[model samples]
Target chain A: MSYLKEFTKGLVKENPTLVTLLGMCPTLAITTMASNAIGMGAAATFVLICSNVAISLLKKFIPKQVRLPSYIVVIAGFVTLISLILQAFVPAVYDALGIYLPLITVNCIILGRAEMFASKNNVAASALDGAGMGIGFTLALLAVGSIREILGSGTWFGLPLIPEAAQEAIKPMTIFVLPAGGFFVLGCVIALVNKIANRKPPEATGCAACPNRESCISVEKAESTVENTKKEENK
Target chain B: MNKLFVESSPHIRSAWTTQKIMLNVIIALCPALVMSTYIFGIKALLLTVICCTSCVLFEFAFNKITKREDTISDLSAVVTGMLLAFNLPVDLPVYMAIIGCFVAIVIVKCLFGGIGQNFANPAITARIVLMMSFAGAMTKWTAPFAWKEGVDATVSATPLAAETLPSMTDMFLGFRAGCLGETCIAALLLGGLYLMFIGLIRPATPLCFIGTVAVLSFFYGGCDVNFMLYQLMSGGLILGAFFMATDYATTPLTTKGKIIFGVGCGLITFAIRQYASMPEGVSFSILVMNCLTPLIDRFTAPKALGTVKPKKEGKQ
Candidate 1:
């Protein structure tokens, strides 16, 4: 049940793309088409899961100072493997994904999970976390891609949805396939997710999850000390 | 018995509330609206009506769904709709116009915390989005008064995109093919003059914006006055400078900031018109400058009274 929770959490509550906003380059670039989104998502997931497991297994062997470089080595190997497999069989998707497929080695979700989860957890839990995160990223990409595709191109997965006559009356907004449309759709999707989840903004939730919490607290303390000295002098 | 009143600062009351200001803006827009209707015929009026109605409806609906205070009474949405309609081609499909309204009122305005809080002018942004989305439809300008021939509207290029320009009088009177409200120099100037007269908008931004464009185009056209005037009169320059660029929310606050913002807009517009593929750049330039308004305001902020300037370390 705990493992399942780890997998389920990434789908909505801890979505890397929609919630945490990780790996935005691929999320914004390759999501013009639903097929490209799935291809990139699947490729990233493979790399993520493999790297997570491998990093978790080798965590004990790696020195703490050089763990990030060691993790990159693991991730690069998996990314290359996936790239070769896709190139060998699904050449069309390989071409469509192009540079983004190989670029997955440095995707923040994979590295983030590797650093934040795999290094600290056992292999099974790390693999589950990777899977959940990878799936979440894919689902978010898919949602954005589908919206852009349907509205921008008047099609779903290259199948014509708008009739020929209707197409003349109202041409599909080609901007949806453009980079601007990708941003618009992504923003709207994130807003929708936030609405559905009733999530508080990061500020309202406080500094517990903030990466800069310690530094921020120290700064606040320093400011208060200065203010205290000033008040004493004034008195 | 005498009545005594106690109050805080700002004891002076004025008749110019938000609704009254918006109403004044609508009244100012009437000249251009009337000119567009005269030039483009009934379709222009119909598009304006549809855009205004849809914009108000979208704002009302969005407010209801978000359970925020009712803001439709301010009439800002109607202004946005009218401005968006003015930006659009007269012959654009009704659905596309409605989509633009949705973008203006719902996405750009309400989603960003409503009217005064919007980062950019909703009408301008929506027009740009519509231009990008429906490029073919957005650019397909119909010749002025083509409907009066009792046949289908003949497609024609706007003055900016045309091979040979129309006579100055024709262009000035708005007998040229262009976006709904942009062709008429006379009507737009009339509206701009009214806004300035009523003190609804300061003259600094619009004057600087138009002046910059005029100066740049003059030099770029090899100091030809006719060419400079044509450049100034063409496209959405006058309409944008007076109405959209001077938007109170998106533009800078201080006089110095407004001047910088206006000059920035003019430079971008000049660059895009001279070098870029797009024939017109008023909307794009204004949008870019709108994003820089906060920075301009920050840099141009006035020092409060009695505040000493920081001493230079090296000089000290």
Candidate 2:
């Protein structure tokens, strides 16, 4: 039950791509085509699972001060391995993914999992977490990629969905293949996911979790000073 | 028998309600609307009606679904629809125009908290989206009055994209191929002047925007006044400068900021037009500047009457 929970949580509750929003570079870049999305997802997932298990196994030996760099080296090694494998076997996807394939070395999802989950957890749990998160990221990419491909190219997985005659009448919007369309689709997908999950805005729990905590805290301080002056005047 | 009503500041109110302002904008747009109809025939008028109706319906539906207050009565959506129609090629399919309307009212406006809260001008953004989606259809311009040829209207490049330029008088009087609303300089100026007269929009942004383009094109064309005039009248420059660039919600508030925004728009437009593959850069430039409006407002915000800047202790 504990192992299953760790695996299932990443599919939805703690989805790295949709919820935590890690690995955005590839999510927005390689999702122009459904096939590219799957290829990229598989590559990233392989790296993620491998790196997670390796990090979890080696965590006791790695010093806390140098853990992050050590994790990067491990992740980079797996990323290179996957990149070479893809380049040798599936050159089409390799060419399509381009620089983004190598860029998986710096993907925040792998490092985030290593630091937050793998580094602290046992090998089994960390591997489960990695597999779950990897699958979640893949699913998210597939959703975004399918939408972009269908609308942008009037096709899915390179098979012509819209008939030729109809395509002439209602040509596919090429913009969906562009970077701007990636953002629009990503936003819509995220919104849909939030709605499906009935996700409410995260409750403010001090400044730690807030992204804009630095600027927000300063504003709060200024506001409090103004309020203090007002109270003094009233007194 | 005097009743005292206590409220915050801005105690004074004006008769310029959202509806009234929208109505005035609609009225100002009438000349260009009329010109497009005349140039493109009944198809232009049909497209406009479809766009306006769909925009209003989309907004109404979105509000109903979200359980928000009905905003359709404000007629802002109507203005957005009309502006969108104006930006489209007259020969575009009705369904595409409706998609543009959905993007304008729903995606760009309602999703961002509706009306006054949208980061970019809804019409401008929707037009760009449509342009990107249907590049072939969007760029397929019909020559003025070519609809008279019955369905097989002679397709022609817009003045900016043409190999040889049309006469200044022809371009000024709106005898050319371009988007429905962008062709006619005369009608657009009439609408712009009316908006300025009604005090709904200040001339600072439009003047600075057009002037910057004029100055840049003059030098770029090696001091040729004719080329400058041609550049000013061509594409969506006049239409965008007078109307979309002056959108209150997406534009800067202060005069200094408005000038900066306008000049920024002009610079981008000029660069794209002169160097870029695309002939028209008005929409892209306006969209870019619209995104920068918040920053412009922040930097140009008026200081409080009695507030003093904090002194740097170490420097002193």
Candidate 3:
């Protein structure tokens, strides 16, 4: 794929969390509420975008030897800025995201993009890559948040979407919102997505079609054996 | 008269096979097997028997019903049965143990394409299921035979009970209140040592696991020695750390990878018991570490004999 297309795909078609399965720490840790997801996503996007842009610009100067340290410094700076901004303006998100917000500096997505795409791409392409990844991360967080909050607390964004009776009955997969739950759910989501993406209908009229036919044949054999056993027993 | 032998296409034979390993584990489990029956009364024996019979029966039936290769003769069913029995509380209802057996053999070992393909330990998964569904019975702890009258019975604290916890010496000595097989550290160690001696198994996995936990606990943990010891002793730790966690299919291959796997189990166990809601973390911790076994193996691959470490990760 071309650099520009690769960059754009990170947005949704190959979103980091939802599609690409990169950077689970932030995806699970910060998405407890919708707002936290937004804040965390914003922090990650800012770092992702800044680091990508800076890495692309500095790609010529830094030797391949020390490029990793240079990228880390740039990413760390952006992460610090996000941390300072949150601490001052939005203490709640700052506190809630806690270790995770700063953890964004090391998130595989930012470092991953810097190493893989940003270092190799032009400034414009790097910027697009960052934005794409940011949007994808945000959307994935929103999906997880929506599912967790609705089920876990019977409320979305502190608003009661559930009726009084339904609220009482809501057993919230209380686990889904926990850090562990985030991972388990994330794993399930990835498996499901893989299943869907790799989904295939019954194969027909191709050489590729019949390789796995033995399992079907075995099923037939099983049925016949059972029938034979029943007939013998009845006699 | 000329006779042609056509059984399993075996041209050469060795004493070792999958069935042999499975039977070895069954034999190793006998000490805990006897201990559990003695402590939990005849019901523990009954449950053990029931689980063994049902697990084998279910495995055979499922293999026939599904027309896959029949697996009961391999003794995996027996391993699952013994492991299931080890996980169950002696006081637990026979039917519950049977359900655990069914789940262990049918769902975990069978449904997931069987044996090696199953993502986690069959017995541990079944234990988790039964622990969740039958919380009350699963946690029923019987006092040691000597202490039943003095401790006031009613599920009194285990010997490894944490700071201000129960008797540490009792836990070390295997006289405590906990799961059927998990209460006795010494006996489990003996069994593990025996397995290691006979060349049936190696100690590289569980020793690193238990050693890491002990070292970490001593250095960083404020939870009392007994509490830590109980953590080691109670709830399938030895059975898992030594036997189940050492599964060749599930655990890593290289020595370095095995150590890393052990360390991962320790860290998770410490983190969960310290931070999470669960007090007993062995089964869950082992299952979690088991999930990472492949990744750990991938990352810490050993330099193969007479070769260099491959850049792509798996071997010299």
Candidate 4:
């Protein structure tokens, strides 16, 4: 595949959060605020790109049986590096992220891309995939974070959007910041994203109607019906 | 030529259609509606109208957009709207109540394939959502008759919060603070009687439900009859037992399952009232039990009468 395709796929077609659904622990936990989301996203992206590059470079030398352990060691090194940097320079975000920052070592997004994409791909392709996926993850976080912050806190980035005089009249829905709110918002976001990406409605029914129907199964039936009609017209 | 109608099931059916059933429920809710207006003033009536209209409108709009047949004619939306409004405080902002109606008709009902298809009671789930999303507004109950004397109706406390418990007669007469429809046990009971008379709901679920709660509270209160009556009268227990816990789609079909469901609801309600921080727990308890209807039905399904039990392995 072209480098552009490799890079661009993760942005939407293969998004880490909304599409692939990796790294949900931090996605749901730390995306309560826009600033926290950005901080966490950027930190995770940094770790992702570095780990992908490291894993790709060492793929030939690393033993096949213990590749998971080696991959974790490499990912952990980058995570610790990121953790120290964030703690030193951005102590506020460090404190806000708390245990989640170090917990990034186990974030499936980083390890997933490292194993699935970087282990087999060339260095440049792996780097581009990492960047694509990182940007995708960051964008997903930003989307969820903005929604939660605006509705739950009446702020976009810790700045009040509703006027102070009107604040008492229009109290924000405080549930969006809580765990249940996070789930509702996440579910809605995923639904919206899926709707946009898959423009064609599933054949003969809605999602709720036939829980057993697979997407491509419907597509296959539709395509074969069309081909049969075309052959009849020719005859 | 003679006409023939082919259908599934036992073939023989009652005259009752979905629309008729829903219309009966709407009629059954009238006593409580009148009582709420009497206690809370004309604002209660206005809120009910707004909620019911918005619910039907939302259902119509959703069906139009989704290209499905309009189900508003069936009157389930109206029933859901009335039930949702009944659980709310009379002083709730109209827009907030409308929002709750939207959650009920659109999210809970329509999204789950509309009437007869939802997994839980739409009104119960919508009330829970509104409770969680807008706790302060949702819980702002004013003193009964406060609206009558033009006394500032901003006082916020239910019967559970009052320093001195209101007299049982006062609570029964809807003179105490509670949800719009729940404060009036007399009205809810009247409605319940009307429903039972019309055969809209069976006595199994409601009777067993209130009975379990009464017995448990009596024992828990050290065999105090007043405490038992107080527990039964307060909260939305009567309203839930009569209207919500008996929802056709959310409750079980078999008699045995309905009894099991009622016992489960009663136990959960007592536990939540006694242990949870929230003063009242009717809607929560009903919603929780609604989640278990399928399981309860499965376990309580009646076996075939003629089927023989299996013999012991050694005997076989």
Candidate 5:
């Protein structure tokens, strides 16, 4: 595959968050604030890149059956390194990230990349894939985080944008900060992205029009088949 | 000019178009609207107008953007707007009321395919959303006639949540703190009776719903008549039973299904009122029942005259 294709695909076409819907726990939890999103994204990116590189370099030595547990170990080591660095230098981000900081070890994106790309590709290609996927995940988190922060808390990155006077006049919909608000904003953002990409929503036509109607033994089909078998036996 | 219009099995037609049904509902709602204006002052009418205008505008805008046929003329959005406003406090900010309308029309109604295609009742769902999101603002109920006398919006407890019950006569005449259109039992009854008379709404669902509430509240109140009457007149029980619970799109289709839906609403409303912290439970109850409408319909569907139910697999 082309090197450019490998790097660009994760940005939109196969976005880790929006397209693949991986790592949802952090995507929903830390996205309450734009700053939190950035911190979480950066931390995850560091871990993902390190883990991908390590896994790719050692791919030949690792046995196929034990690759998953081995990959987790590699991911956990890098996660610990990033977590300790964040805690030592940037205490605020560390506190804000909370339990989610350590959760990077099991973030599906890291493990997914290790299994899907790093295990098969060389170190350089795996690292590039990690960076692209990391950037994609960060952008998605930033989009959701910024929207939720501005509307939910009336601030973006700790800066109060909606003036106090205007806030008095109009209360920002506080629901955006709430969990339900997270769901609503996420749904709208995903819908907007899907629309921009000109994606067709899945059709919800019921079983009557299902494409597998021929082989599927629905109630009507079962009854008809039973009747046919009974008639053949009688004849 | 005697041309035969050949068609499928449904050759017979009725005069009840969507527009006619919605217009009839709007007309039925007029008595309560007028009563609310007199009781709650001009703000009630203003809120109603704002909600109706915005709901239609939102529906229109959504249709324009989505390239669908404009359906605002059918007046369903107007009905949804009126119902939503009726569920809110009269003193609620016009913009908040507009937000509720957006939730009702655009999000709940339109996004779910508009009008008859929605799963839950739009107005009920919007009221719940607003109530949950803006708990303090939504629960601040002003006393009856406070706006007329310029009483600085003295917040008072609703009859349902009040320490001492108001006189039955006052409650009947709607001189109590509650949502704008739900206070006046007489006006709601008149509107409901008119809808029944015009055949716009069947009496089965409303009667069963109100009956269940009355019976349950009576037993729950230790067979006290006055307590049962007070429970019946307070909150949105009358408005929800007569107007919302009878919504054609959300309620069940068959008579048996309607009764089941009504009983379920009554049970939930009773549970919420007696146990939950929230003062009122009518909207939540009706919305919950609306969610179960398909299940109710499926279970209570009328069997065809000559068709036997299919046998079980093990039963030859």
Candidate 6:
């Protein structure tokens, strides 16, 4: 596949976060902060790119029987290398990434692509795929992180979004930053995006045939007043 | 021929209809509702009625505008109303109960694809939402009538309050003021037992969950063991374990998985109550376990009898 295809595929079709549902642990955990997103994204991207290329090179030498352990050793090597470099140079990203950096060896996205794509593909194709995928994963992490940071922490990339006085007035949605909040937001995003992409008429089950339609006067009262007319007719 | 109406997914249909189950649930919460009003005074009764009415109205309006299938006839709106009332204080401002109703029946319940499809317990989520929005009102526990009004209007602590712990007996008897359905043990148990009798819920989740909590409390809970019993009886445990945690869409179907679900709920509930800063743990624990239901179901699949013991072909 062309390099552009390699990159764009990861962004949408093979998206590690949404489409493939890989690397969910970090995707769900670190996305709580934009800074964490950027940092975690970059770290995972670096590990992914390196791991993919190395795995592609080693694909032939490793026997089919022990290919999993084979891939792990190579991935572990890259993860360790990144961990050392982060600690030596940028200690903060290292500290922030915490044990998660080491745990990257287990991230399903990395191992999945290595097993499914890179190990079978040429070295050049594997590298391009890695960069494409790394960027895609980074984008997802950043997106998820930005949402959480703004809503949960009352900040974006650590900047205060709410005014200082208003901050005290309005309680930050503490749930947004929490683990369950991560699941809720991700679920909503999935449900909403699926609705748009599928373009099926919205599945209806609530107020249309309802007996209390006259009393139920709220925004969900719907656009097509035909529903109201019919509700009244039924009444 | 393309059909004009189509029932959606999980194509498997049980004998139970949504409306019947919901009616059963409302019945389950009724004892609590009645007992709370009797203990807390006419305010609790009025608050519950207001919440129930507003919830039904909100569901109606949401349906009218959305042009979806009318859901109020199913009594889901009623269940939401009753659950909301159950979660709230009798002393709460009427409009706040309306807001709670709106959040329960509208935002949390409807927005997430209505009724069974909602990710969390709508009442609990709404309660939490209200807790955030009106923390003061949510926590303002009124003392019982004490047979005089102005004499003892003091804002004494809830039974959960350590310094002013109601006698375990009083808490069991529903004499103190708390959330509408949560203050009374006998009422909640009666409601739970009624639900069990109706078969809206399996006994395993509530029984195992409560059982686990009792044993763990004996070993780990710092409070008196009987206090743990009172704690289990007092708050939203009955409502959550029987009604919310066992929500069909959110919980596992198999018997063993339900047990594991109950155990997980129990452990998390106990952990939160014992270790966390919060006074209650039922809602958080149920929601957390709700998230894990899919994974639990995946693991606890009942082994097919034939698969476990493959019959020998002609040779046998």
Q: Top DockQ: which candidate number?
A: 2
Model 6 agreement with the true structure over B1-316: per-residue lDDT tens digits:
5678445334668888778778777877888778877777777788878888898999889988998778889887887788778787766777778877887888888877777777667777788877765667777777776325644334666666557667767877778766777777887888888887877778999888888887888776565777667667656776777777777777887889999989998898888887888777888788788778879888887778767644667954
- Ranked by DockQ from best down, the candidates are 2, 1, 4, 5, 6, 3
Candidate 1 local lDDT, A121-191, one digit each (tens): 88898889889888999999999999999999988999999888777897888889999999889999999
lDDT of 4 by residue, A62-176 (tens): 9988988999999999989999998899899999999998999999988888877898888999999899999999999999999999988899989999998987678787778
**In model 2 chain B, which range of ten residues has the least summed lDDT?**
B1-10
**What is chain B's TM-score across the candidates, in the order shown?**
0.94, 0.94, 0.84, 0.93, 0.94, 0.87
Return the TM-score for candidate 6, rounded to 2 decimals.
0.65
Model 3 residue B150 distance off true place after TM-score fit, in angstroms: 14
Query: Looking at model 1 chain B, which ten-residue stretch has the lowest summed lDDT?
Result: B1-10
Q: Go through the candidates in order and give the clash count of each.
A: 0, 0, 2, 0, 0, 8
lDDT of 5 by residue, B243-303 (tens): 9999888899888888888888888888899999987899999988998988998898888
- Write the residue-wise lDDT of candidate 5 on A1-235 in tens digits: 8877777877887788886678988999999999999999999988888988999999999998898999999999998999899999999999999999999989998898888788878888888888998999999999999999998788999999988778756766777878878888888988888888786754754554432233233545666888999999999
Mark the regions of model 6 whose C-alpha exceeds 4 Å error after superposition: A53-74, A116-125, A192-235, B1-67, B89-156, B167-177, B184-233, B237-316
TM-scores of the candidates are 0.91, 0.91, 0.55, 0.89, 0.86, 0.65
Q: Flag regions of model 4 displaced more than 4 Å.
A: A199-235, B1-12, B304-316
Question: In candidate 5, which residue pairs get closer than 3 Å at backbone N, Cα or C atoms, i.e. clash?
Answer: none
Which CAPRI category fits model 2? medium
lDDT of 2 by residue, B1-316 (tens): 4498443222458887889989999999999999999989999999999999999999999999999889999999999999999999998988899999999999999998887889999999999999999998999999998877676567899888799888989899898999999989999999999999989999999999999999999999999999999999999999999999999889998899999999999999999999999899999999999999999999998888999965768954
> Candidate 4: lDDT of B205?
93
Task: State the lDDT at A10 in candidate 3.
Answer: 74
> Each prediction's Cα RMSD?
5.7, 6.2, 15.0, 6.8, 7.3, 13.8
Per-residue lDDT tens digits of candidate 3, residues B1-316?
Answer: 3497344312347687878878877888888778766665666677778888999999889989999888788888887887778777666667778778877888777987776667678888789877765566677676667334544345655443433545666666566667777766677777888888888666888988787777776655575764456566655567778878887767777788888888888788777766787777778888887788778877886567999654666656
Residue ranges of candidate 1 with Cα displaced over 4 Å: A202-207, A210-235, B1-13, B310-316
Clashes of 1: 0
DockQ of 4: 0.48
Which stretches of candidate 3 lie above 4 Å from their native place?
A1-235, B1-14, B146-153, B158-169, B221-231, B302-316
